[model samples]
Structures are given as structure tokens and as C-alpha cells.
Target: MPAADAGGTPDPLRRLTLADLRRRTSMKWRTYEPDVLPLWVAEMDVPLAEPVAEALTEAVRLGDTGYPAGTVYADALRDFARHRWDWDFPASRTALVPDVMLGIVEVLKLVTGPGDAVVVNCPVYPPFYQFVRHLGRRVIEAPLDAAGRLDPAALESAFARATEGGRRAAYLLCSPHNPTGTVHTEDELADVAARAAARGVRVVADEIHAPLVLPGARHVPYLTVPGSETGFALLSASKAWNLAGLKAALAVAGSAAARELAAMPEEVGHGPSHLGVIAHTAALRHATGWLDSLLAGLDRNRRLLGELLTRLLPGVRHRPGEGTFLAWLDCRALGLGDDPAAAFLDRGRVALNSGLPFGTGGAGHVRLNLATSPEILQEAVRRMASAVPDTGRRTREDP
Candidate 1:
């Protein structure tokens, strides 16, 4: 077991230093040069939770590398949801999928069709645009409010535009939103459900980040809201438990959407890795303590980032996210043009995610992963601060 922080929670982020993290071969680390401090991707620096690791190890030891069986994964999620957020849904209403994004694609197929408009809150997960367009569906943007909250008017406008010509449309919602980390409040979600219902638009919420909701915020399951019984949700332990590489997720159907979910090809359940299912089940069933510790470390790192930017890189603006270990940065003030991440990587040798890919309102912004050690976070900020041009100013006056 690891030592606990002042909050009496194990600081998972503290367990890995830059040196230790460098050994990682994941996209988060390997995408950049070894000398660069990579903080662009969602992969966390912490080791796997003991329970999850033990489960996978046991599975392999017994040569249980076969297809998944039973509703154990969904049952575990149900227990976690009920305990954590007071939410519940019968296991029969869920379907196993390869992963969240693929699951989203599958669900979208059931709700919308080719040439149909699929609405998304802009500056969202880029994959939303990619997958939707690839499926031959149109991507309609409904930009978020200035503070990164969902905008009712924007949604209404998009919904109206989408349902034009009596076409079926779907709204792909990112609850506990990525990059911004805005956890949708219950009232906000209720409004979304009502508005989406009234507009005849199906809601497909991606709540993969639900379990990672930080302090002072709560995650409202979109399906739990009134008027949302016809919607669908994609949930997974991938983001919360660092199991993205394992690849397994659940597709949940709202009460009225259950039949539509069942219409999904039975073969879809065969896509997820059997081991991935086991790992996710173990995480939800027995890794709550580890998740809590990770939340503590993330909370601390978010605060630390705000302070670092204030002192070291004043030109950059960041609002600490309400959930998840990601931070959206407004680097527009830095005069680095639209893609400040490029500048940071080239000059500072710190690779942060470019804002260009995140869609409207994303330019001049960057998405940073905060799930690393305090030392790496501090070093990354220092490198970013050094990357800014001085404009021929004297000591302490430069960026």
C-alpha cells in the first residue's frame, strides 16, 4: 500500500516521478521525444490499482484468456453507480461494447442515420467529430457557454437545425465534460433531457468520466433525468481506472431505449477483450479506495496547476476543472497564435494537446493532462513559461 496524503488518501500521482513516467510506452509518453515532458494525453502516471492488477494476473495465471461471459461487468457498474451517485438500472438494460467511442458509434447508428445531423457541444472530445463524420453523419456544432457549461439556446438552435426536413438526429453529450471537466448539474441535465425530448432529438451521453468527478461537484447520470427515458448512455471504467488500453465498456439504454439497445447486433458483445471485461469489473467492484486516492491527487494537482500558471505563465489562463484529471488552457493571451501547443513543444519541449482539434472555441486553447506527479507538473509549467518569447524585456518583466 502507498502512503496517504494529508487527506488520508493515497496520492497515486505522487508515486511516479518524471524518471519513472518516462519508462511508460503509452501514447501519453511515447508520442513525444524522451526529453520532452508529455502531458497531452489522458493516460495517468500511476500504476494499476492492486485489485485490478491482481484480477488480470489471476486470469492469465489460470489461462482464462477467452471470450467474456455473464453480466458481471454491468452488475459491478450498477453497484458502483448506486453507491456513488444513487443511480441504478437493471443489468438487462445494458450491452457490452468494445469501448466507449465504439459504443457511442454503435448507439448513434441506432438513433441517427446516414446524412442525419449529429449534434455535439463544441470544443468537445475531437473523436466525436471524427467518428460521426466517418459514419456518414453530419456533425452539427452547438458551442458551449463562455464558462464551458452547456448552452440551452445553442442546443435548441442546433436541435432545430438538425431536425430540419423531419430528419432524425442525435445529441452526443459529454457529461463531466472532457478537457473542461464541467460536471453537468442535475438541473442542467434535466433541462437537457426536457429540451432534447421536446425537439425529438435522441440524447446519447458519454459518461465515461463519471467516476472521476472531483470534489465540490456531482455527476448526474443523464438517463436518470426526467424526459430522458428514450435516450442512451455509454459508460466505462476506462477513463476512471486507466483501463483505456484494455478496451471494454458498457452501452446502457434508457427505459424507452431498451428495445433499441436490444436491436444492436449480438456480435457487438464479442468485440471487447475478455480480459478487459475482467479488469473493468474488478476495478468497479474492488478499486473504490484506489479511485478515491486518485481523486485526491487530481484535486491537489488541479490546484497546483492554477497556482503555477498564475506565477510562472501569467499569459496563460486556466480554470481548474470540476472533474477528471484534464485541464483546458486558454493560451490566447500568450500571442502564440491559434496553436500554442506547437510552440510549447518546439521551444519548451513540453508536449501539450493542441486546441485546434477540439472544434469551435478550441483555437488558442490546449488540453493538458494533470494526472502526473507534482514534480512533473511543476517542471512542465516551468518549461512552458520559458517557451514564451520575452519581447526584449528585462529580468522578471518577460513572459
Candidate 2:
């Protein structure tokens, strides 16, 4: 258990200096102005750990920047899986993917065809709907329950209906779920696995946010379910380690169906970047303390954000996060009419991920990232409160 400094100071292990973040933002956000606080993207403001940075810097200096070939990152990934999830994944069996979305695209191509239906839980990662439509596959949404938790009964019912309808439906599972931060329990995952297995449906579990789960909340890999050896798992430290620029991810599949679906025979040129492999390996092998610190920082940030919102704006309700640093806020109480995100941006000058894009159920909502510093989180909440009139007085403790 790595810990952060009290009073919201950056932990030395997970220190992401403001200077490096400033430099990185100039190129990435295009709004390099020092005033803007960027919480829109999944990337965190934290600096890379010393070990991870040193590994990449050393690899670059050694002139190791060539086409990746062989087990540079494989062993590190195996060790990471073993230590973090207690799951054994043979290094030899894992496939290197340039990006997680690319792997999802590849799997979609293999499992479904034009007019085939691909089922997704609503208010999901935008890519879940985008990928299926990109490949001419019909997107079928099985929405999460009112509690914002994935409903196993709804999922099972949907699968049975799809099976009866003769439509080939593949499920995309997001754990420690993005945008909402709900961590699926083992029993929930087991039920999903059982449903998919019984219905002859393939499940693509996106466990990218697994590393950010809070202390008490656990993220169960879809493959850990009994008889789920064949389930496909798309995992990467890119989200956890904020290595999105490196463009590296892992695709895990032990079952014959998963293997057959994930394998891309035509794309010989697509492989992991040397820097990505080096950074990933280093982070997995040596950056455990740093990661733990980040998880703690994120958890604290989540609490602080909630407190700020509850004190300042009563109508905007949010359920405390179970995982991930993102929180889904119900802004319907504020009569912003439609597109509350746009109204907030116009009045609050803060850019939040709009809920409508997630699905109909997500309307009148906004997704905020609490992964940044306490200062930034407080400022965002202040701006949001100011944007909307404080008519009601409700605090987190009131309920």
C-alpha cells in the first residue's frame, strides 16, 4: 500500500511535476495557456515515476528504437498480472497490440459481420458504439440499472433475446467502468460470464481501468469466472500509467474462440513501439509503489470533488466512486433544459464530457475527471457552482 502525503500534497513516488505537465500540455491540448485545467481526457496530470522515466530514457539513449521483436514487454506483463490480479497469464500466449481500440476493432471484425448485432452497456466508453458502427455492425445496447450498476438480469435477458432472434451478439465489458467508475464485483462478472457462455456470445472485457480501483472495491477480470478461460480480455497500463501516447496495449485470450477472434494475420507491421514496451515493462516491474500512490491520490480527489460539489451545488448529485477517477454527475436538477454540459461550459468555462454521447439514459448528466490535483478539482467545482445558481442547500453528509 503506497500512500500520498496528507493535505493533498503530491506523493514523491507518484510525483508528476507541474513543469513537465506544462510542457506536455503545450503539444497535447493545443491550449498551452497556463490557466486552463484539462480534465477532459483520460490522461492524468501526474508525472511518470522515476523508474519508468529512467527506463525509457535509458532505452532511448541505448539506440533501442527499432522495430519491436520478441519478449521485451511480455515478461513484465506476466509478472504484473500475477502480482496485481493473481491471474496467471503466460507471456508466450499474449499478443502485442498498438492500441486497445485497435485490438477491439480487430476483435469486432472477427466476431461480427455487417448487420450482425454487437451488444454494449449504455453510457459506456464512446468507442463501444463507434467501433461497431464503424464496421457496419448494429449496436445493441443493454443499459445499466438505475443504480448505475450493470444489471445481470437485463444482460441475460438481452442475450437470450438476441440468441432467439438469430443475431450474433458479442458483449463489450468495461470493468472499474469508465465515466462512472463502478467496479464490477466478482459475482457480477461471474454472472456476465455465465450468461455469455450459455448464450454462445463472446465477451470482450476492457479492463483498462482495473488499476485505479479504490481500496475496498475489487476489479474482477472477466476471464477469472469459472469456465471463462476462453474470454477475451483487453488490458493495458496505458490508462493506469497515463502512457496513452506510447500506443501500447495487451490482448489476452486463452480460449480457442478468443484466440481465433483476436489474431490478426494481415497486420504484420502493427506491433508495440520500443519506447512503449520499455516504459510499460518498467512501470509494471518497478512502479508498484507509484501506482499505489496514484490510486490513493485519485480516491482522495474523488472525495474532495464530491464534498465541493455537495457544499456549493445541491442539485448536481453524484454517487461516490467505487473505482476509477471519473464521476458521473446528475445535473438534471438544474434546469439547463437539454445539453447541460454545453450550458455548463458556456457559463462555467469548464469542459466536461457530456452525458448525452454516452446514451439516452445519460442525458442531463456530466462526467468529471477527479484525477487531477485538489486545487484543480476544487476550482472546477467552484466554477460549476458559480455557473448554476445555488438555490437548494444539500451537502454530501445531508443524505
Candidate 3:
């Protein structure tokens, strides 16, 4: 007997197996083998892009698995940056850091200090809050407005309050926002930049998921906005190509102010992995079509899951996801006790991110990553609908 071969389809969204459709997703971190499905973690089950794998294999075959040094590595990264995002990222300003978290820490070191206040949007990536606290800075939650998108006025208010309190220094921005999946508009980014600049706050934009943006949504590079040069851009190939293990990310600084943020002592002395260099270049050149196919697959899964939730369990409110693969589910109407994460895990046998960690407003919600196959989503939804209490439900309009 032999294992069946799934088509070497570069697209991860379309591949689903009968087993996948039957299993529950797991969100537990302690145990890798969850009895239920495992969708809680951000990692995807897809194999690496063929080109990325080939590049790594070729690098290993040549036995060049040492620390990166010299101009060739920088040139490869520069070329990829120019081609992929259409931005003129100067290779000179780019530093090959080991990972994005390190980049964030370094930026925090430079732009802020103990007793300083760091502004971040609510329901953001958890690390944004952690990074600020780890650096001994106070966190000011400038939560997104009612639309689940950045509200410029709220940001201005937060900035003013921080200034009045004399704790302002840095702001961390997630472009294609996490948890909520709202892609910020150009005007929104500009307003944030203008406000931050006025209050002498430097912005660090984490764009790790920029490459994974869905169709019909434009990704505006933070530096592209006027006065954006006052901010630093943090990006990585980890999320898009699933190369996180290779551990190479870039910190791109446009203006002198931003460059100063990147040149902190804590940021220095880190080395880049040779494999990350090779894979990133291969992905930029050969994986464009693959990325497009994957995005389409993600979009389909998102819609399918939304539709299923609507029909089977009407109270679960979900919008058509705009950017990232994450689906923000409003499970307030289910009324299955207070903790939705625990309820879904225990009763539904589906492990999902608890919405409370995202912020107070995220309470009674759950964040589901739709990056997996359609079959998996179907089963996950099935478990959820089964576990949810039978409260008389209403459609989206009833809310």
C-alpha cells in the first residue's frame, strides 16, 4: 500500500482530504496531537513552494549553510524587494535581521524607554502588546473604530492623551490588521502617520502578512504615505512563503528618523540565515502565480465557512474577510457560557484563539484562521454548530 499523492498543486487552499473533513481543529499549544482539529496556531499545513524548497535543497547540497556575509546576499534581497512590492527599498537601508520579533525589540529600544507610552490598536497581534511591556513601556490602546478598521480620530485622541500624560514615544501599526482582518486605507495610514509625527512618536509598521493579502484589496506600504518616512517598516518572508523556520526578515527604514530606529545597539550583531536568503529570492521570482492561487483558495475557504456558519448557526456573525486568512467570528449570540474559546474547544472539539486576548471589545468573539483546506473548515464548522446551544437565531440583518 502507498500513500496517495495530493497533486503537487502549489495552492494550499484547494487540497482537502476526507480525513480533514472529519477531524476537529486544535488550538492547544501544549499538546501537538489534539483529539480535535488544530487551527489555533497560525501555521499552515501546506508544503513549501516548490521553488522555495528547491532553493533550500540546492543551498544544502552546496553545503553553504553558514552565516550570511558580503554584498551578494544584500543584492538578492534588494532585487526581491524592488520586484515584489514595487517600492524602491534601498539595499543600503535594509538590514538582514534573524527574525521580525528581534526587529520589533530593537525598534522599541530606539524609539522608547522605561515609563514611555507605546500606542497600538486594540485586537491587534498579541505581540504588539507584549513587545511594549517587555521593553518596560506603558501601552496605550488606540482601538479601531466601529467598522473594525483604524479610526483616525480615535488615534488622534490617544496621541493627545499620551502627550498630555507625557508618556508618548512610539506607535506600532499592523497594516493588514490581525485578528480583525481589516486592511487599513491609505487615508487611514496617512492620518496615523501625521498624528504620530505631530506628537513626536515614531511608528513601526509590521507588514509580515502584506504578501498574503486577498484580492480586491490594495496593500499600502506605510512608507508610501506622506510623512510615513517618520516610521520604520518591518517585513518578513516567513508568513507568505511559510519560511519562518529559516528566520530571515528585513527592517526597512526610509527617513533618517526611521533609520535611527533600526540602528539601535540591540538590533546589531544579529546574523541572517543563508537558507532564508535563497528561499526569499526564489519566492519573489517564481512564486507570484502560486501566491495568487493560494490567495484565491483562501478567499474561497473564507466564503465557504462564512456561508456555512450563516445557514447552520445564524447568530454567528462574520463578514467576508478583507485581507488576511483570519476569520473574526462574532459568537456573542451563541450564549454558550462566558468563555467562547473554552466552549468551542470542549464541546465543539475545535481549538480556536480566544477573542478576549485581542482586547475588551473582542470579548464573545473567536478568531479562526481560514488558511487550511476546505474540508477542514467544513468539519470545524460542523463541530461548532453542534456544540453551540440551540438559541433561536436570526440572520445578519437582525443584529
Best by lDDT: 1
What TM-scores do the predictions have? 0.97, 0.91, 0.89
Please state the error at residue 72 of candidate 3 in Å: 5.6
Q: List the residue pairs that clash in candidate 1.
A: none
* Ranking 1 against 2 by TM-score, winner: 1
lDDT of 1 at 259: 95
Report lDDT per candidate.
0.91, 0.75, 0.74
What residue runs in model 1 are displaced by over 4 Å at the alpha carbon? Answer: 1-9, 391-399
Q: How many backbone clashes does candidate 3 have?
A: 7
Order the candidates by TM-score, highest first — what do you get?
1, 2, 3
lDDT of 3 by residue, 8-98 (tens): 3446655545355345333233443446776776766566777888888988899978876654544655565566656675667666777
- The better-scoring model by TM-score among 1 and 3 is 1
Candidate that scores best on TM-score: 1
| lDDT per residue (tens digit) for residues 166-257 in model 2 | 66778888887877888888888888878888898888888888888887777777777786765778778887787888867777785565
Give the TM-score comparing model 1 with the true structure, all chains together: 0.97
